[model samples]
Target: MMQTRRKKLSEWVQQLYFIGPSLFFFSLIVLIPFVMGMYYAFTNWNGVSNEVTWVGLDNFVTIFTGDENFANSFGFTVRFTITAVVLTNAVGFGLALLLTRSIRTKNALRTIFFLPNVIGGLLLGFIWQFIFIKGFSAVGDATGIGFFNLPWLGDAQTGFWGIVIVSVWQGAGYLMVIYIAGLINIPSELMEAADIDGANFVQKLKNIIIPLIMPAVTVCLFLTISNSFKVFDVVYSLTRGGPYKSTEPVTMDIYFEAFTNNRMGLGAAKALIFFLIVAAITLIQVVITKRKEVQS
Candidate 1:
């Protein structure tokens, strides 16, 4: 018993030796910042001067009761999240289906498709901004087609669609890879059995493929939703929430509130509220997806 106890003690010591540095850094970086932010959320910190007074829940109350822009930003985020999530998943799943088939240059095509995701969001936004403003106008001037010449970043509706287009282009490839993994893991025998039973492609997809790939769908949906909700850099680079705050998502609103407006406490409150909303939505999605995964 003494020998076993000594061995266990030695193992624990070895484990601690391996984990101590990581734990120390994690506590210093993540835990410390998180605790500090939580405390600051309830304080009137200007983020510049060292004077921070505890304001209780005034920031939260102001945001919920007084801030019109906050409400608008939240609504815009919701709309963007829903649209982007659906479009990203649909395009991604379609690409996955196409890439999973026997093709001459499937690997090269996959690489090309995924290349956009490797590009930085800010860079991608700037590139797309030029495309929307200059390239579209040039095309319009040359061909007399109004479609390419539409005021993409000037109009609220057009700006919304422009953001959606850019987001889908960047996100679909990453989600496609996930869907491909899920697709490839599906039992070929099941597909063969479906084929033998005279189930067509659509039928097979609707029944077997989709049902079996619920986990991947769940992951993609969660990622796309969260990403769309928190999208800031791309929008900031592309439109800067222009056309009278029409394109402002929650993150941009929070950023502008905190940094530009010098309302760090209010920004922190917004951040906390945003975190809670995201957590609640994600938890609900996870519960539903987990239930589906189990049923499948």
Candidate 2:
């Protein structure tokens, strides 16, 4: 019994040795701040002031009742998330299908496509900003194409689409890599059997390839949804949530509330609400997709 206790103690020490540093930093950086933020959410603590007055649910009530900017930002975020998620996944899956074939340039094309994802979001946004403002204008003038001639970022509608385009361009490549991994793992025997059974490309895709790739689909959808919802750096660098704040996401709204407006307590409330919303949406998505995976 003493030897067994000693062994258990030794195992505990080894586990602590491995996990202690990471847990300590996580507590300091994430857990503690999160707890403190929850506390601040109930107080009226202007960021710079030491006087924190407890306001109970006032911040939350104001947010739900009268915060027009927050509502507007949330609306924009929802629309952007929907549009970006669909386009990014479609393009990514399409590219994955094309690249997985027997092609001479597949490797090079994969690398080129994925290159944009590696670039910093701020830098990518700036590069695309210049392209939309200057390069598109020059191309429009040269080609006389009405599509290219439209103001890409000058108005609310165009500004919204501009962000969507950049987001899709940046995200699709990374998702393509995920799809490629899924595609490559599918057994060759399955394809051979489908061909032997005289299954057409579309039929085989519907029945076999897609079902088998459901795990990758679930991952890709979750990633795109969360990333699109939390988008900030790209919007910041590209539009600064502008064309009259038409492109502002909830993240930017929280940021301005906290730092720019100095309403730290209110900002914390907004953040908590945002976290709950995002968590619920992502959770639902995962649950639905996981069901699909199981059925497949």
Candidate 3:
């Protein structure tokens, strides 16, 4: 019994050496802030004077009742999330399909496709902003393409699409890498059998490839949903939620409320609501996608 107790104590020490530090930091950085933010969500803390007063559900009531900007931002975020998620995954999956084929430039093309994702979102947005401002104008002047001459980020409609275009371009590459891994993991025998059975490319893709790659689909969808819903850096650097605040996301709204407007309590309330929305949406997406995932 003494030896067994000593062994168990040693094992627990080993486990603590591995898990204790991570748990400590996580609680410190994430859990503590989350709890504090939750407490502030029900108060009227301005973040400056520190006279935190409990206001019950006043912040939430104001958000749902009087905050038109937040509502508009919420609407914009949902629309952008849906659009970005679909386009990013579609482009990524297409790139993966093409790159997985037999071609001399396959490696080079894969690198090129994934190059955009390597750039940070803020930097990428700035780069695209310059391109939309100068590069597009120069190309339009040189090539006489009217489509390229339209104001990319100067108007509400164009600005929204401009953000979408940048987001899709930036995100597709990362998703392509995920898809490439999934594609390579598929067995050669199954594809060969499909070919021998006179299965056309489309038929095999519909019947075999898609179902088998559901794990990758789940991962990609979840990633896209969360990232798109929480997107802020790119919009900040690119548009700054500008042109009459039409492109503002909820994250930006939260930032402006807490820091810019100094409504810490309102911002905390918004942040909590935002977290719940994202968590619920991603949870639903995971459940739906996981259901489609197969054993293979």
Candidate 4:
């Protein structure tokens, strides 16, 4: 019994050795801040001040009742997330399908497509900003194509679409890599069986390829949804939550509330609400998609 206890203690020590740093940092960085943020959410603590007064639920009440910016930003985030998730996954899957075919230039094409994803979101947004504001104009003048001549970031509608386009352009390539991995994992025997059964391309895609790739689909959708919902760097670099704050997402709203307006408590409340909404939505998505994966 003493030897067994010593062995168990040694095992425990080894486990701690492996997990100690991760647990320590997670507690220091995420867990503690999360709890403190919750506390701040219930108070009126303007950041950088020592005095914190309890305001109960007033901050949340005011947000739900009177904060137009929060509502608008929430709407913007939802729309952008939905649009980006759909377009990014669809384009990524399509590219994966095309490139998985026997082709001579696919390697080069894959590299070209994935190159944009290598750049940081802020830098990519800045690059696209210049293209939208200047390069598009130059191209328009030379080619006289009205599609390229529209004001890309001059208004709310254009600004929203601009964000979507930028997200899809930068995101699809990364997702394509994931889909390519999924495609390559599919057994050759399954494709041979489908061909023997006289399945058409669309039929095979619907019946076999898609179902088999559901795990990758779930991962890509979750990633796109989270990234799109939490979008800030791109929005900051590209449009700075303009024109007239039409492009602001919930993250930017929280940032301005905390830093710009110096209402840290209210910002914390907004952030907590944002976290809940995002968590719920992503959880639901994962649950549903996981179920589909099991069924498939």
TM-score of 4: 0.97
lDDT of 4 by residue, 186-250 (tens): 88999999999999999989988889899999999899999999999999999999999999999
Q: What lDDT is obtained when candidate 3 is compared to the true structure?
A: 0.95
lDDT of 2: 0.95
Measured against the true structure, the TM-scores of the candidates, in listed sequence, are 0.96, 0.97, 0.97, 0.97
Score each candidate by Cα lDDT.
0.93, 0.95, 0.95, 0.94
lDDT of 3 by residue, 1-296 (tens): 99999999999999999999999999999999999999999999889895899999999999999999999999999999999999999999999998999989999998998899889888999999999999999999999999899999999999999999999999999999999999999999999999999999999999988998999999999999999999999999999999889999999999999999999999999999999989998999999989988874
The sequence of per-residue lDDT tens digits that candidate 1 reaches over residues 21-119 is 999999999999878888889999888999999999999999989999999989989999999999999999999999999999999999998999999
Tell me the spans in candidate 1 whose CA falls farther than 4 Å from its real position: 294-296
* Superposition error at 267 for model 3 (Å): 0.4
lDDT per residue as tens, model 2, 2-108:
99999999999999999999999999999999999999999999899789999999999999999999999999999999999999999999999999999999999
For every candidate, C-alpha RMSD to the true structure in Å = 1.4, 1.2, 1.1, 1.2
RMSD of 3: 1.1
The 10 consecutive residues of candidate 4 with the worst lDDT sum are 287-296
Per candidate, the number of residue pairs that clash is 0, 0, 0, 0
Task: Score residue 5 of candidate 4 by CA lDDT.
Answer: 100
Descending-lDDT candidate ranking: 3, 2, 4, 1
In model 2, how large is the Cα lDDT of residue 216?
96
Q: Which ten residues in a row are the worst by lDDT in model 3?
A: 287-296
